[model samples]
Target: MTISNLQEVKSRITVFGQPMICRGCSHEVFIPYELYINVEKPGIGCLYAHDIAICQNCGEARHFSDPSDFDNEKGIFVWALRQYVC
Candidate 1:
């Protein structure tokens, strides 16, 4: 998806791999294995190119997984923000 601004793609994002930081505790989390939510429509190319994100301070749950499954951008962010899972 070609987005002119980062905000356009902000909602279709998720966290993968090592933890960057925590949202609540500000703790740095590390994953020996891939600790992230699976993307809904992660076809072929998108497998390696995950939009995973994590807190850089505390390992709390910021963005969970990719919301590419959803068609609407606003809906994706709404879902993500509601669960705090992402």
Candidate 2:
């Protein structure tokens, strides 16, 4: 992605009201939510998904197939646990 495009995407992202604790470092930080658009080639419809989370403290990241599944209590807990173990 070009710098301009990345900047635009970053500006448009919606962050959660409540920050989540970093799974790797336990630091509280807002989890950014964004729609990722993928276009393999012209004429092909774009594929979109909301699926990325990066821990600001430790630089750990997690990806989900579906964005809607993220941030749910169970998912968050599991993610935190996994990070802790890893």
Candidate 3:
């Protein structure tokens, strides 16, 4: 499950939007949680890290690969959950 090339791993999963307002309570504050994917193959290895924003008022969560990606009118986050070996 080791990834040979870091670039080979790609994700196109948009979890949520920026300034993520809690759908439950319309809360603006959120708590961030770190996420990581670990790959272990015969001759390759890779580790990808991401973040998930959780609303403090409503406890809703959204996933994003990069924090900076959230700074936009429409936040589009991608995922790299798959591993590629070379």
Candidate 4:
């Protein structure tokens, strides 16, 4: 999370950042993304999405995926709700 101008407060991350919208309530804002940072070796200072944030109300999830090539390949991070009950 080495975003130069990144500012965060409570559950919502703000200021020109990507909107992490809650699947349950559209008005709710969030930023509980667990990111994997590359700093040991190889391409240093690389940020990859590698965590899961589940919607408490709806019991859905948002998976942050890291592609094969961190630099070349693109990361696919999306908010997908699991709509079902047993």
**TM-score, every prediction:** 0.22, 0.36, 0.41, 0.31
RMSD values for the candidates in order, in angstroms, are: 10.8, 11.2, 13.6, 11.5
Best by TM-score: 3
Per-model tally of clashing residue pairs: 17, 0, 5, 0
Candidate 3: 10-residue stretch with minimal lDDT: 1-10
Show model 4 residue runs off by greater than 4 Å: 2-10, 13-16, 24-49, 65-86
The full ranking of all candidates by lDDT, starting with the best, is: 3, 4, 2, 1
Error of 3 at 45 (Å): 4.8
What is the model-wide C-alpha lDDT for candidate 2? 0.40
Candidate 2 residue pairs in clash (backbone atoms < 3 Å): none
lDDT of 2 at 29: 36
Clashing pairs in 3: 1-40, 1-41, 2-40, 2-41, 11-79
Preferred candidate (TM-score higher): 1 or 4: 4
lDDT score for residue 27 of model 3: 63
Q: Candidate 2: where is the Cα deviation over 4 Å?
A: 1-19, 31-33, 37-43, 63-86
For model 4 the local lDDT of residue 21 reads 60
**Best of the two (1, 4) by lDDT:** 4
Best by lDDT: 3
Q: What's the best-to-worst order under TM-score?
A: 3, 2, 4, 1
Global Cα lDDT for candidate 3: 0.45
